[model samples]
Target: MKITGYTDRLSVQPGENIKFMVNSHYKTYKAEIVRLIHGDSNPEGPGVKMEKVNADVNKEYNGRRQEIHMGSYIKFDAHPLFATVDSFSLQAMIYPTTPELGTQGILTKWSPAANTGYGLFIDDKGCLALWIGDEKGNVEKISTNQPLIAGCWYFVGGSFDKKSGKIAIFQEAVISKTNGKFSLPYEAEKQNVSNERKVNIQPFADNNAPFLIASVIEKQPDGKHKVINRYNGKIDRPRVACAALSKEEMSAWIDQPSGKDLIAAWDFSAGITKKGFKEIEKIHDISPNKIHGVAVNHPTRAVTGYNWTSEEQNFVHAPEQYGAIHFHDDDMTDAKWDVDFEWKVPDDLKSGVYAAHVHCGDDADHITFFVRPKKGQPTAKTALIIPTASYLAYANNRFQDIPLAQLMFGRAPVVQQEDMYLGEHAEYGLSTYDHHNDGTGVCFSSSLRPILNMRPKYRHNLSPSLWQFNADLHLVDWLTEKGFEFDVITDQDLHFEGAELLNQYKVAITGSHPEYYSGPMLDAVEDFQAQGGRFMYMGSNGFYWVVTFDPENPSLMEVRKNYGNQGWKSKPGEIHLSLTGEQGSIWKHRGRAPQKICGVGYMAEGFEVSSYYRRTEESGAPELAWIFEGIAKDEKLGDFGLVGGGAAGLELDIYDEELGTPSHAVILASSEGHTSVYMPVAEELYFNIPGLSGEENPRVRADMVFYHTPNGGAVFSTASIAYCGSLSHNNYDNNISRLTENVLKNFLLDQPLPGAEKQQVLTKN
Candidate 1:
């Protein structure tokens, strides 16, 4: 995999130092900072471009190798009982994901500070391996007979005896069904492999606090301990006994009740709540000594365990079945690279997108960051708040398996370099749309890692076309082309500063898919609107699913997808987001659908073809003629352009009074001639019935809505993701362009729109 990097802060001001981190396979590399000019792939449109900003930002660093331990494992605080142990027995259930990587740490008490400890891990040869290194670095290592296959559950463990001076380790396959339905693949049956090694009867590593699992601590020469050799795979209940157990005793412990020999046993599936899961920061112990451990990177919790029967999906109800932690070798939250260089934005720099462009031989990459005008400064009347949370949710996503993906695209997507990189590097991490090794869907995502798909020219794996960040760039390109001055504030900015961050701008624009929102973010938008701040929900599916972020842990974002308008459902009791204690799923389920603000909420979606919007009778009314000024009454708005070659297609929304569409809201236009594949949203249906398809359902279309809030605040929604992509077509002279220009002209004016004053009267009526 090629090296990539990201900044800690999305948008930075001059005098603020932003950390720059890189993940590289090579040691020698160069870096520099550049301003991003444009991020589009359309050969006909503005091509890939950038501008250099600083010479001091350019430098070189010999990037150190940092191993990302992917598998989730637990560690207990050291007690006199655990620390004094000389010989002990350890056992765990392992489902190897990458047995070929070799030397996967299953459990260990090894820390490099003391350079001593014992551990049970899978060897590089994919064999059950046991290693015991003493204080002097003297070691005894041994492995099992045959190779262990990947994705199969096995019972691998060992026992060390001080009196006998022998270390015994064995690897035996668990032939039974794993998730109650998944059985191990047929492998050649051979005698169980148990190896014994005679070692010096020295006390185990005396380091009192070096105990860990999945990784070993290597004390750097600089006196800092670095965690290394992280194992990649799933690790189940790992138990440690104070002393060695006989083979027969071990056999009994495997299928029978593990007796008092267990000094400490960790059940990785103990705590997650429906009321809120944020309280589950520590895993509760089941052993007599309750030395619970905290989960790092929150490794894929609520996953299926070896005991899962496939009968219960909720981990809360069947905790035993959800005891596994799946890990990967490439799960990076931050590259943590030594900063080759850092810069505070100069005060005079414009509020736009910028990046640190790094060149390493033939390979080149960019570490992007956004710049906002000085705090409290309004350089422009309008601000475009990027849906960065939604970007995080779909970051580095793999949607090729979704049945709708290919069917919606019509043809196979043209794979980009980022797509191929993602496919080859599954260790980079999974999107919220994906599932863990145990089959439970993934919900939490973090931006501390390299998200290749978030870059310019990045294309969707299934759609080939630009999506989220890249697709949003189409609108960015439009605003720049039209010479409209606007400050760029990200969803992160809205989350931190809340309403105050948006109050300065007369109006705020949203990129296409604002699918993820936190309570504060939603409140900020609503409060800004309630106070007369105009909102331009420029795309469909705005304010959709709920998400959570902790300022304490800014790099991590969490979501619990359950109960609405999505592909995968969260486990029942786990529907509440653990990060913010808020209920997940769609915002509509929370009684705050997008329609309440913009008069349009998600309705349906089809990717094959984008159709045009027909002007409603409401649009032609003399008072409302301004929105359609200079356009023929019979003209089909946005009939030909970029995305799907029209304005509405990929995903559409509708105006519905029952769903809280404002009573005085004017639906100026509605898209028509949609294909059958565009089906209504899941929440819109009470039952699976026929004719819920695009052509049959009246609501399967986008609504062009304009509504005035109190204090001159207004909301105009295009209600389609494909809307902005059409703006640059025909050299920006098309009907879509004209209509948008007209709206912007009216929206940018200093007073309430003349027609909207009448709507206010109608609202009071």
Candidate 2:
């Protein structure tokens, strides 16, 4: 049996207790502490490594039972009269997205055990297709003339006649068009696809089992039945007829799915909540036949429907639009199970990355979390605030499921076992890159459950190297090797405690992709820097996207990527977040560009190749020479190492005075030799031009920057996500490591720099 778990809290301090919640089908399980050494299982880099914590947590959770809540789904047991339908018709109102790719099941009565049944679904080419199989294993299939467009509602249906040996399908735009042409872009090609279509087909089949909506039951090679090819859009008012209906009759049924001669009809609007005529998770079939089914994957309810007029934003006001059910292939609200064991951190436990190591027979996995120092007790001069918010945004992302990513990466994807598990068990929920049931992009993400991609060795679809959480761990290993004692904190802590949380430490460090931030967290960091706390922003794209977390439920966070900057623009009136009611977008839109606090902000991103930084004349100026004390004047910093084999790669940031980069900020070394694939971030360019790549656009490269603030404060930015990955080169004795050591060793002394003292004298005058 499979097992999984989560904690009520993401991080805990010594002397404080945290609860562990588990969902498993096993009788017993054990938990123990395992200090995380390295998460990347890259054989060329660091292999997966963990060490047992000599604590007393190695105990079994006995007598635990699993609670069943397998998500919302429709189910109907077999009935003799319903099984004799070899010839039939199917109809549904659909609003689809990503219809051009991936198999999407709409209506089906297929049995994998016998491989004998019938189904009507969207094929890989986005065209509606009808397929039927007989006892002899012969199969018949045909599709519509043209593909359906995404983001538009359509009346779709098909029929089969065993007697005539012929079948046909009818597809039309829900909103009758004057020209009969729709214009929604295909995701990858950005080419417009239409919906007006007609097709013909015929099939003989055996309906010995129940019919499924939005999903199909398929037999796996392992001899187990599994649900696959879940629909990723709205499905409303579905019905089946025992006899073929004329094209005109089928078109009229769009508004009347419960017409006469029907085998079954479903009113999706019925039984929405647990108190509504039925208990939790049960959906009633408001039809004469009472073909009831349960909602599965917790497909979103109360959404804008196939016939929505865009006149109402709150679905409660428009009951018709609310009738729709949104089914995402990667949707999961929870995986209800029992706790394996709990940990009440001891009073003396050190703050660091720790894991709850679990094992059942030969199967094993680790549940990782952070331990921070007790409130008001600062244990180290340096504090590394984990970018946990960013982690949550990109958690177990579905980028691999998109064809656009494939083209950009220049190769077909290699989905690890972890990726396959995420697709099969959608109970874990969706990432920011995925769309919701209503064809709207997902804006909220939570970490209350296991985020498969946040572990060690996890690689992102955007980059071959480690990213977000895993990439940040590179710095952790570096600090250990260098014998630097550091305290651990998180973006959550910074948001909740304000600047006070960082006042205890002399310096604070950010991770490799601290992309999401709340107003309070950004303010706290700025205040800390202004009050003489040294800030080491070791990553590109830090403090970029704005986000807000649920105070009542700290595990969940929200973000809305409206049309301005990048990736999946939000629809009108939906940009205001439900959690905080804040207008969501990039930080730059709110006048808080990364340059404002760290003297550098997001500039560009590239994956295929990485380059190194070449020192500028300013780096050797008498006042800044101390930063390059041990390096030769001609030495190329971060020229060779892990992560693209150089420091400046992946997402990069650059200094921009107009965007609030300190007027006095000094650019020491600017990364050179980025390939043409590296281009300026979209927002920076008013319009696309020939010279936007790294080879031409001056702003496309990372510029290592340093600037001084009031009260002896300073900000040092590495300006590249790949910077830390090179810190361990030559066994931690490389120039990049040396330069970073100089910055931190000087900052940790808790004294002002030469320029800072001069500024202080001028202020006193």
TM-scores, all candidates, are 0.80, 0.70
The root-mean-square deviation over C-alpha atoms between each candidate and the true structure, in angstroms, is: 5.6, 9.0
Error of 1 at 584 (Å): 1.9
Candidate 2: deviation at residue 686, Å? 2.4
Model 2, clash count? 19
Residue-level lDDT tens digits of model 1 in 263-326? 7777766565553344444766677777677666566555566666766655655566667766
- Worst 10-residue lDDT window for candidate 2 reads 188-197
Residue 335 of model 2, lDDT score: 48
| TM-score, model 1 to reference | 0.80
How far does residue 142 in candidate 2 sit from its true spot (Å)? 28
Query: Whole-model lDDT for model 2 versus the true structure?
Result: 0.73
Cα lDDT of model 2 by residue, 604-646, tens digit? 8877667899998888877676788799989999997667789
Would you list the C-alpha lDDT of every candidate in the order shown?
0.74, 0.73
Model 1 misplaced regions, further than 4 Å: 1-3, 23-32, 58-69, 74-83, 87-106, 110-117, 120-203, 206-210, 214-294, 301-332, 360-362, 400-405, 564-567, 686-692, 695-697
